[model samples]
Target: MATWLTTFSYWLLIQSFVITIILLPLSHLLVSYLPLYLFNYRSHDSPSRYLLFITLFIPFTIIFLLITDLSHIVILLFFVWFSVLLGFIDHQTGYLPDLLVYPLLVLALLFHAMQSNEQLLLAIYGALVSYLIFWFIYGFFKLAIKRRGLAQGDIKLVAAYGAWLGVYILPYLMLLSACLGLLNYILLWIKIRYKPDKIAFGPALASAGIGLMLIKYFKEDWLIKIIL
Candidate 1:
């Protein structure tokens, strides 16, 4: 069983890498037709080739390493792919289209449903909780500061992440995302010596989601063990 698992892991790694390489160029064409908001249409530009390659490669490698179950790996590969797409779109156009995010939410719910009834319930709860929390924050910022703290697309993105990862992990996701955002802000300030009025939060959130997923994947071996 151990040997078989190792062999399977290697095979998946190779296959995923090859697929990523093939899909990199094709992604440029696909990005053109993405459902972007009217305002974003003017800013629709492709991500750099290096950025695209890194995005595809990291998720594939992480998912392949962390998931022992083949079915779980397949589902996560889909999740990772779409998360990257959303991140790319947000980075490029500062918009997260419902066309992509809603389908991802549906897929995450379906994936959890296949796992068990309890998991499905947790996913639903996560989605609702995440959305409501963000909605509250949005309202608070609007009323208190007279500015939008988060875009609607960002709220939906977190909700989708909740559906995929479960409610229990939402806090960690948020914390990690905030940390990443702060780091990004600091880096930009240092490099450019000027802070932009707006920063795309989706990429940081997506990155946090991915990072937490990897932690969850290896929890049994390392995280849980350490905690216990």
Candidate 2:
């Protein structure tokens, strides 16, 4: 058990930090291609070449070193991959695509079926509840503030997190993302002063999702200590 816990923690760290950097520019390329196809832009750079290299090369190295259960690792990768993918698009376009979001829900359902029989119901319930929460919050804040504090895209992102991580993790992902966003906003606000420059929420979302997956596998005492 201890051995599994330690390995899982290391895996979480890699997914949040190392895998994020590894996937960064490649996801950027995905945005480039899909956008061009959607809008027919001529000047976009090719993001395909890097796509092949990152997906193939990095996983090869990680699996080579880890030599653990492939099923477990693949499940972990599913959540992190979507988080990075969403983050990349949010940074570039300021909107999350319904195209991507729906497909991801399908993938989450697939993951739910294969890896998590017991957990699937709770996860789905979380998704629906969180989706409503964000939707309601979006409207109320818009009415009260007379300005959009968060976007529908962000609600979809939060809903996705809830779907994949379950109700218990819903709060953690939000709290973690908010903390990181607060820190980021303060720093960026100090420097840029409400310029509406496209900031990256993807990384925070990805980081928080990763934390959700890993925290449960640790010893409870350590988890509580970290929370404190």
Q: Write the per-residue lDDT of candidate 1 for residues 1-228, one digit (tens) a residue.
A: 123245457777787789788878876545555734434475435468788778888788767665668887777877877788788777777788787789889988988898899989999999999999999999999999999999999999999999877888898888889998888778878888998777788889888887777666567664455732
Candidate 2's displacement at residue 67, Å, is: 8.4
Residue-level lDDT of model 2, residues 5-45, one tens digit each, is 34555555455456556666666666666555653544444
Instruction: List the candidate 2 regions with Cα displacement exceeding 4 Å.
Output: 1-28, 38-67, 193-200, 217-228
* lDDT value, candidate 1, whole model: 0.80
In TM-score terms, candidate 1 sits at 0.88
lDDT of each: 0.80, 0.63
Displacement of residue 143 (Cα, Å) in model 1 is 0.3
What's every prediction's RMSD, in angstroms?
2.8, 5.5
lDDT, model 1, position 29: 47
Worst 10 residues of 1 by lDDT: 1-10
